[model samples]
Target: MVMLFESSTIKNITIKNRVMMAPMCMFSVEKEDGIVTPFHLTHYESRALGQVGLIMVEATSVTADGRISPLDLGIWSDEQIEGLHTLTSRIHAHGSTAAIQLGHAGRKAKTNQPAYAPSAVAFSEDEAIPTEMNEEKVTETIDAFKAAALRAKESGFDIIEIHGAHGYLINQFLSPLANTRTDRYGGTREGRYQFLRETITAIQSVFEGPLFVRISAEEYHKDGNTMDDFIYFAKEMKKQGVDLIDVSTGGLVQAPIDVFPGYQVPHAETIKKAAQIKTSAVGLITSGRQAEEILKNQRADFICVGRALLNDPYWPKRAAEELGYVIEAPKPYARGWA
Candidate 1:
């Protein structure tokens, strides 16, 4: 059995249990874009009460231009900060550590305004081509990440996760296939990583919470992004003070994935062993016994749960019960746990 009581830590934040909530997009918020809608509070509070060790809020755009979808939550302005405070406080009240994934969609952005990337590439599925960014726009994006990190800190989250994986902006930069720029942000491997490196560095200037970057360890396309890329990216991030990597894969271009139980655990294992950084494993991890084995074998430091929990909100508590570990339920639900 995975030791249910085993605590997990990343930099300055400690989680009371091994299970973490993988960020799932709600895209449910008030029309103001930055403000929290009622749906977000209840959706997250239930997970908090369910006793997950840490809860990562869905990715919030670093700026309006960065939004993955128009309906996504954000903290680009002061107005967005207050509602997030309520979110953090509620998560804390349930004894769960709160985390948020800050992101920019890059060419993937589908908001009403024009989308942008290193080149004017359109996703195969989309009709509109993304506007390739100019030098000034790139610089401004970096600043936006920095300012967003500062605002997230002000919102009282215990940890900060950069959205580097799943074919987002940073992932675009990481892949040789998508980025063919001739500027400082392109060409060689070091050049490809320049955008992500700069983004993390700029965010570091304003925030010091546990820094976690979500990464797609493998790109499904063998030549597109190499495991060698992951090795290099992981080491560089650690050197730049990245505390943990939330390891997941295959969001490049929305293609179908061939997956099995714990298919992505190898990515976590590879990074933990090679880069010497803490890592969290996601993708089809559903049960306590499976999760425990991964931790015991040193495959992953933390277990990130997604869809399974959506199926059963008390998945953690039930897993503990099944594994012969005693865990307390919230008072309102204590009798059932007992």
Candidate 2:
């Protein structure tokens, strides 16, 4: 049976193990220029040195106004390439493949700049109603995703994960609750998914490496997208050359979601079985035994360790020991681990 320590490969890239670092926003850019800082280099390298299989960088903006916050990283311009390239080189040097989550926060964007969305709606009462995106604007955003993909390739990322989850721009378009447009980009499920399809097509044009899409499978609202809806999306993503579906939930609306260990694992398992695509289970997955069971049961191809990894960069190394798997630690750390 596949275990957490066993390596997994997607397309041409091989991951050292099943422990993937989920993309979490850092909001650490001191200059607000969207360029990565030395903090990012150190933060990611620590995970790589800790033996995480794949280190996915935080949600990086594809456009100036697409950032979730002014402090988020940006890839809309070529100037940011140097920092990202440096990051990828460090990750590779330490035996981990680097990946990045390209995203546009859309109406959820908290920057001072005006936000854009499929519909002219506000994420909440305090937030401003965003300008509805016309065809021209939509095309511009898609082009941005394409440009960002090329930048990711140039930066040497082994995988490009489209951040379509967490109530971001793509999720805003996908969720009926946030999108009430009557145009071609809304109304029906296919219409709601059109933006993502176009974005994927655009990215695939330049990126030949493994592609992944993270989606909020359960919107937590009665009228929002459901498991079946996500399965359909997973199938569509497969047709669009998506190598994996990063399964996450409950970012479409501000509803209370009960938290528990492995709450989102079933969503990943369901999508993997129905959509016939590889998947990564995320959320509250904190231990090696839990991750191993999920893989052994064929629920997911990878286990995304989020907050646990943040809390302890060496979480994976500790997990390996707990599972009785002797994962090779870095030479200097080997004596301490021994």
Candidate 3:
């Protein structure tokens, strides 16, 4: 166990370190067409060169209706694949593995126009209420995921992470509180798990690399989903060839969370224990010691930092130095190390 410093493998891919840069939306893309502009390339390349082991690209929607923002990257068609390929190639040149986060906004879809969801519910005070998804739309959504995985492979990504966390369409379906359908998609726990299970199986057909699913370990509502749901989902996902469970919490409804240092680590612990699968702990993880403890305790397989890396893109190199690794500063910065 002390050899936790050793490299880790998931399927065909290997992460040099367990440190990953969490996917966070920059909402910086000026185009509504979801093109990978200079801003996207620069932002990701900076982290790769700065020494992050693996950087999951910000949530890229599988369809226009799946996007969190109009400017978010989309893989709905063949045209979008080239731009992502460019970005992935750039990350590889910098010696970091590139991962694409595929998502669907679901009920969270639409901001200005007609929104959609598993049920007619408003997620936030300002957001519009969304329409429930019919069976036809659900089948299309699964195909969209499969297509997105294909695009991720075309773009040369080392891994593809399905965005099932944060009250997105997939998570909305996972939670009985949000998913009220009586058809094949809702009702019993297995029924609620169907969407994710099918989505994973569909995507697996296209992506042979390491597959990841970011899930809300706890929906944070008495009536909503819980850790047990995610644990069950994790085991099923593993059986379906999912490589890791990116552990996260809440986002079913817009409510303030009582956050503290390493607040969601326990969520990862519970899921890891129950599912006995590789898990990635995210949210409020800051220091090296805290990250190290998570690894040592078998609480998580990966420690993902989003805003923390944004604040200091060089944090990985600094973290390595602090954690007793011989970190090599950039050639330009090496003189300062003297």
Candidate 4:
């Protein structure tokens, strides 16, 4: 049997397959109000119809000013719940589990509003210097994440992933390269981890469903968090009741990286073994056989396809054919698919 096509359970949810459509931001919001648009509905539902097991929505901001871009989706307000509910319902109708990634851009935010970060640092020379988050700001942001998780539950999502990767607010806090402070929120590795630790604790208070945290295991710099640091973080997450770690690398700061088809798989494997937790391998994993090899060898529990799925909404069907395992298609495409 092809392991990629096999079912797996997380919490009380049974995902039909190991193939998950990795959350890639569309930045397609018609208005700056951060509401879901028709394009989003069509974009995500296509993958669901194509037999992908999990369709993770893009990075959704928890606050208006926390957005990476004005066009990013928002769960900061109750009004946005209706549109997201419709989206989750559409995905479910086609037998796909829906997940949303909650994120805050921090210093990387490009909006007109001033960005906020753990330290008053600029992402680059060209980027604006962000305001250092004070005690009140930190508490407010943590509360924002907790509130967003509740909103996700109200929207009918099956899972929630905290976007702690890609050099965002959480990453800034977790990485010593970006965070430099003497307070409890920075300095040592444990101090740097305090923000994410609190954020996870906050989200868990309200969200009981399967929770996942995506992290950049390798920061690609000498001073960045090492593999040992990542393993410690993963173990801590497991103790905190996180169900999975979606392992990806880089994006903490500007640094050269070697890119390859399965470059990020090794990190996932290391984290899984070191932490004794489930992990999803992402980054350029483009074929069924490759993904199957990883799963068969127990390198990673799930495969997250990003650009490959964007290139072809029916990438899973093509993968099934490559592995000589047929997956049932949506009824409308039955004639062509068969």
Q: What are the runs in model 4 whose C-alpha is more than 4 Å off?
A: none
Give the candidates in order of lDDT, highest first.
4, 2, 1, 3
Query: Which parts of model 3 have CA positions greater than 4 angstroms off?
Result: 1-5, 111-113, 330-338
How much is 322 displaced in model 2, in angstroms? Answer: 1.0
TM-score for model 4? Answer: 0.99
lDDT of 3 at 26: 76
lDDT of each: 0.87, 0.93, 0.83, 0.95
TM-score against truth, every candidate: 0.96, 0.98, 0.95, 0.99
Counted clashes in each candidate structure: 1, 0, 2, 0
- What would you estimate as the lDDT of candidate 3? 0.83
Which ten contiguous residues of candidate 2 have the minimum total lDDT?
1-10
Candidate 4 residue lDDT tens string, 1-338: 99999999999999999999998989998889899999999999889998999999999999999999999999999999999999999999999999999999999987889899999988888788899999899999999999999999999999999999999999999998889978999998899889999999999999899999999999988888999999999999999999999999888789899999999999999999999999999989999999999999999999999999999999999899999999997888899998
Across residues 1-59, which tens digit of lDDT does each residue of candidate 1 receive? Answer: 34655887666788999889999888776584757888889888888899998999998
Q: How well does candidate 4 score on lDDT at residue 59?
A: 98
Candidate 3: tens digits of C-alpha lDDT, residues 98-210? 99899889777654556667777678778777888888888988998998898889889999898988999888888887888898888888898899889888988877889
What residue pairs clash in candidate 3, if any at all? Answer: 107-116, 107-117
The alpha-carbon lDDT assigned to residue 179 of candidate 3 equals: 81
- Which candidate model has the greater TM-score, 1 or 3? 1
